[model samples]
Target: MKRISTLIAVATLALAGSSFAADRPVHLRGEVTAVGAGDFVVTDRKGTKTTIKLPEQAQVLDVSRSSQAAIQENSYLGIAAAPAPQGKVRAMGVMVFPEAARGLNEGHFPWDLGDRGTMTNATVAKVVKKASATELEMRFGGKAQQVVLDKDTVYGQFVPGKRELIVVGAKVLVIGASAADGATAANAVMVGRDGFLPPI
Candidate 1:
């Protein structure tokens, strides 16, 4: 009886671990190549294809082209960045949030872009343009941070969108939940608009 009970406890822990793994967020960036009744296929930049299940009520946002000129003082932004020298971070991509999105997820957090990547959703306190790059002083949750953006950094703006925007040929950044069986179901999708690809 003692051995049987230990085996059951071990099984329970294994099941719990699997459940937690399945709940991890999956991020995908690609172009829609096919659309079906309830799902779509995306071909990533590396030419790998993935089928993603889209729930009926998944949140969708349209990402439009944005430029460095649009990033001004006091602009609320979401920046994906990686560690840099001198206690600063280098911007991988920057998203200028719409007025309605101010304060949305406003804080610095770990991101999946890489092992040390981070995401900062904050309000710009100051902007400084250098000969080769731009620097932003951002504030969120009473904390201030600095990030550097260069010409290689991509930019976009988020707007409201619907399911219809998930059609073929559209580029998208998908945030989804992965299942134990390796399937992914989208929780939110950011679709690029007007031939612009989502930068983050």
Candidate 2:
């Protein structure tokens, strides 16, 4: 009887310990009304208002950091002081992918393209015509097509078999990163030529 009693006590204590640990809380991403010095009061995904403490600037990940410091530095939004275990993210801006955006996004829309997002392979079939160095008049499907750039003002001119055909018989797959606002062309930002971007 005493041995059984002791086992019960041990199991009871274990259960109590688990319950106590559960008392600890976690923060979820939500809408922010404003920003302040060290802490920001945000409406959590659950629709509850919670205050989160911001780390020092040095802890933030400047996503904008790129070959062109002046141009890319501005794009960074800052990541967590310490990266999450496995494939998790603690802060914002590190930009791993749908995983990083999962919790924090809460239901938010896309922020911008090329900021650690996915890409699609779109082929440039033929140049229906030429608009300029910045834009393209290509046919992707059986119909006429026109592609333009808002930032670089220069379309990628791929080499052809015998001519600078601009877009004829050229099959260059493009990685269409998430647009700034939506999934459609209405939100895509014109990021420069494709290259190796550093990891977060």
Candidate 3:
């Protein structure tokens, strides 16, 4: 009876330990409302505010302006566009995902760009520039879509951002762990340069 009791006690302790395991890192996107000594507050699109703590060596990435020339065949991309006439999508913005982010969010779904906007993550099969806008033929999962782009369309690529770039009124997408004090301790923070948001 004592042996059985000992085994049960060990199993119980293991289960209790599992309950305190840290949560998986998640992404948080919002506009910075405040910046403190080692932390900042951001308000998301839904108006929810979250406090995020930055470690001394927190990784920071800056999203800078890019051009269609940067996009090449077989490049993974995420496009936010609105439906155009004849079943086409007119691109409002394009985000070039790095090779490491390939296959992330790999599908087309409704987005929040226009009245009935859509977001597509795919590989660029072809790119043709017209007199006014550039057209991209993108394919993913054996499906295809035509995305139209123009100079007004924002393009963003991530680069290492200096810590000083973290400031009030800046938009950020942070990947990190949630702390017990209701703040997120960031592993990496991506911010837009020159007032643009990180599209990916």
For this target, which candidate reaches the highest lDDT against the unseen true structure? 1
* Total clashes in model 1, counting residue pairs 3 or more apart in sequence or in different chains: 0
Instruction: Give the Å error, residue 20, model 3.
Output: 18
Which order, best to worst by TM-score? Answer: 1, 3, 2
| Model 1 ranges off by over 4 Å | 1-22
Worst 10 residues of 3 by lDDT: 8-17
RMSD of each: 11.2, 23.5, 12.3
| Residue lDDT tens for model 2, 86-147 | 43222222222211222221121222223432211112333222353222222222342233
User: What TM-score would every model get versus the actual structure?
Assistant: 0.84, 0.20, 0.64
RMSD score of candidate 2 (Å): 23.5
**lDDT of the candidates, in the order given:** 0.77, 0.24, 0.72
If both were scored by lDDT, which would come out higher, candidate 1 or candidate 3? Answer: 1
* Ranking, lDDT, top scorer first: 1, 3, 2
In model 3, the runs with Cα more than 4 Å from the true position are: 1-31, 37-39, 43-60, 160-165, 173-189
Per-residue alpha-carbon lDDT of model 3 for 1-200, expressed as tens digits? 32333222221111211323664444677898999999888889999988888988566776777877889889888787888877889888787766665665567877655688788888999988789888889998889998888767877776456778889988887766775655577766778887777764
User: What is the C-alpha local distance difference test score of candidate 2?
Assistant: 0.24
Residue pairs in candidate 1 whose N, alpha carbon or C atoms collide under 3 angstroms: none
